[model samples]
Target: MWAFLHRFASPPHFYRLSGRMAPWLGWACLGTMLGGLYGGLVAAPPDYQQGESYRIIFVHVPSAWMSLFIYVVMAGASAVALVWRMKLAEVVAVASAPVGASFTFLALVTGSLWGKPMWGTYWVWDARLTSELILLFLYFGVIGLHSAIEDRRTASRAAGLFAIIGVVNIPIIHFSVEWWSTLHQGPTVTKLSAPSIHLSMLVPLLLMAVAFKLFYVTVLLMRARCEVLERERNAGWVRALIAREGSE
Candidate 1:
């Protein structure tokens, strides 16, 4: 298993593998997103309390979930790059930052849209919201730090350290509602027992979450492939690959 894993640490191998997998993942993401959106928007009944405004959760909840999920992935890749000095891992970590940042931004926007009708305000300094906002800044910090450094390896190391340090905030974001008084609601789908949401609602929510994960995989692979090509531009294999494509 270690040998198999180590083989992909090679940039050429990962570049080829990711290119082959991206198309399939993209199609799957599209299919799942369409299904989820249809079910969430058309099939599911309105909430007894919030009514149509609650429909925003189809987009809001998935984006919020992806925000945390992608950060964990970024941090994990950063750790591998730091410990193993793996180029592919560094590419993955950097490729994921912008995507994660986009998700975080989407979550904040959708949450604000949802809040206007529910909370009677567009923004608040509630614990959960505040922590999530901090997360967006952390993402910006990583991106800015990575771009500012002249050396790619050094930049990866710097960003990796920051990501590792920032991971502490994930737990804070997750438990913010439970640990403190906040306008945000607690977990409905991730509870210890059965989820509190109805099955019809739960299915679409779960589907959307899965679709978002697939979307991340699809975009991450594409971005990582681009990063790999840029880093490997001077390599013989890369030049040969480009020549072969041009010839064809």
Candidate 2:
């Protein structure tokens, strides 16, 4: 298992493997997303309190979950790159930033849309909301820092360290509701016992969450593959691969 793991650390091997898997993952993502949307929007009964407006949860919840999930992935990849000097890990770390940022943006926007009717205000300085906003800024910081540096290695290392440091905020974001009184609803689906959500709603939410995860994987692989090619452009293997492609 360890041997196989190390083998995939090779850029060429990962590039080929990801290329083969990405298409399948892409289709799976689409199918699951469509299924989840149908279930959430059509099949699930409207909330007794929030009514039809609560349907936005299908999009808002998944986007919010992905925002945190992707950040953790980026930070973990950064840790691996820093400790092992793995080029693939570095590529993955940087490639994930934009995706994570986009999710964070979606979460924020959707949260605001939900909040307007539910909380009677579109924006607030609530703990969860503020920390989530900070998360978006952190994503921007990582991308900006990487682009500002000319040397890729230096940029990656710098961004990696920053990501590592920024991880402190994740727990804060997760626990912010408990740590402080806020209008934002607490965890409904991740509770210790059975989820508070009804089965009909839970099914769609879970499906949407799975779709988001698969979507992230599909896009991450595509982005990491492109980053690898760009970073390895001067390598003999890259030149040979380009030549082969051109000839084909």
Candidate 3:
């Protein structure tokens, strides 16, 4: 077990493994996204109250969920790099930032679009919204800090620390709607009494979430491969890998 684990930890081995994983993940993501969209947009019934407007939740909720999920993943990667001094871990955390931030931005924009019709306003200072906004800032800060530092090792370490420290905000962002009375709605799918939403709605929401997760995995592997190449540029295997890729 230890031998297998150590062998996999080697950069060259991991790089090769990740390359093989990427295409599978990509196809899976594409398939899941198609299925989920079909289920959400066409198959799901309209909400009794919100009517067609509730359809937006299919996109809005999943993007928002991804925004939060990716940040946690980035934070976990950052922690691994900081603690174990893993270069690959740092690369993963760095690579994940922009993707996570983009998702966060998508969430905010979609939420705003969904909000206008429901709340009669495009913006609000509600707990959930405000906390999510702050999450975007955190993503920005991590990315900016990583770029600002001249030394890659130092930069990664610094960013990793920031990511770990900033993790506190995640819980606050998650529970804010419940912790304090706010305009934002409380837990719908996460409720203990059973999901507050019906199966028709729930199925789509879950499907979208699965789609988003698959999408993230596909993108992350691509980014990770890029990162591996860049970081391992001077290595013999990298040159061979590049030559092979170029030939193809």
Candidate 4:
């Protein structure tokens, strides 16, 4: 098992394996997103109160979910990298920062757009909103810290520590609506009880969540492959591969 894990963790092996998996992940992402959009927009009945504006949930909710989800992934990867000194984990942690940041930004924008109709304003310093904004700045700090350093390993470790510290905010953001009196609504689809949402709406929301996760994997692999090449460029294997590709 150790041998297998060591082999799997090697940059070349991961590159090849991720290359094989990315296409499938990309296709799955495309299919699910299309289905989710169609189902949410065309099939699901409009909310009795909010009407068509609620359709933004299809995008907003999923993006919000992804923002938190990807940060958790980064935090976990960073932990592994710091503890085990695993280069692959470091790469994954760093590669995920930009993607996670983008998701966080999207969530903020969509949430603001959503707030205009529901809250009668485009912005507010609600608990969840404020915590989420902090999360975005956390992502930026990780990214900027990673880039500001010259030694890649040192940078990853530094950024990884930053990521680990920021994880305290995850639960805070998730439960903010409950912990404080926020304008944001409480849980509808994710809770201890059966989801409060109807099947038609729930299905698309779940589908969009899956699609976003797959999208992250597809992009993460692409970014990791590039990272691997950059980190390995001076190695003999990389030189040989580069020569072979050039010949072909």
* Per-model TM-score on C-alpha atoms: 0.98, 0.98, 0.95, 0.98
**Model 3: per-residue Cα lDDT over 1-248, one tens digit each:** 97886787678998888889888987887887788788888998888888888888888888888898999999999999988888878988998898899889999998898889998988889889998999999999999999999888899899889888889989998899889998878878876898889897788789788888888887887888787777788999998877998999
Q: Give residue 180's lDDT in candidate 4 (0 to 100).
A: 100
Q: What clash pairs does model 2 have? A: none
lDDT of 1 by residue, 13-108 (tens): 898998999999999999998999999999999999999889899999899999999999999999998998888889999999999999999999
lDDT of 2 by residue, 1-248 (tens): 98898888788888899999999999999999999999999999999999999999999999999999999999999999999998888999999999999999999999999999988999999999999999999999999999999999999999999998999999999999888998788988876877889999999999999999999999999999999889889988899999999999
In terms of TM-score, how similar is model 4 to the real structure?
Answer: 0.98
User: All predictions: root-mean-square deviation over Cα?
Assistant: 0.9, 0.9, 1.5, 0.9
lDDT of 4 by residue, 1-248 (tens): 99988998998899889999999999999999999999999999999889889888888888988899999999999999999999999999999999999999999999899889877999889999999999999999999999999999999999999999999999999999999999889988878999988899999988998999999999999999999999999988889999999999
Instruction: Write down the lDDT that model 2 would get.
Output: 0.94
The best candidate by lDDT is 2
Clashing pairs in 4: none
Q: Runs in model 3 with CA error above 4 Å?
A: 244-248
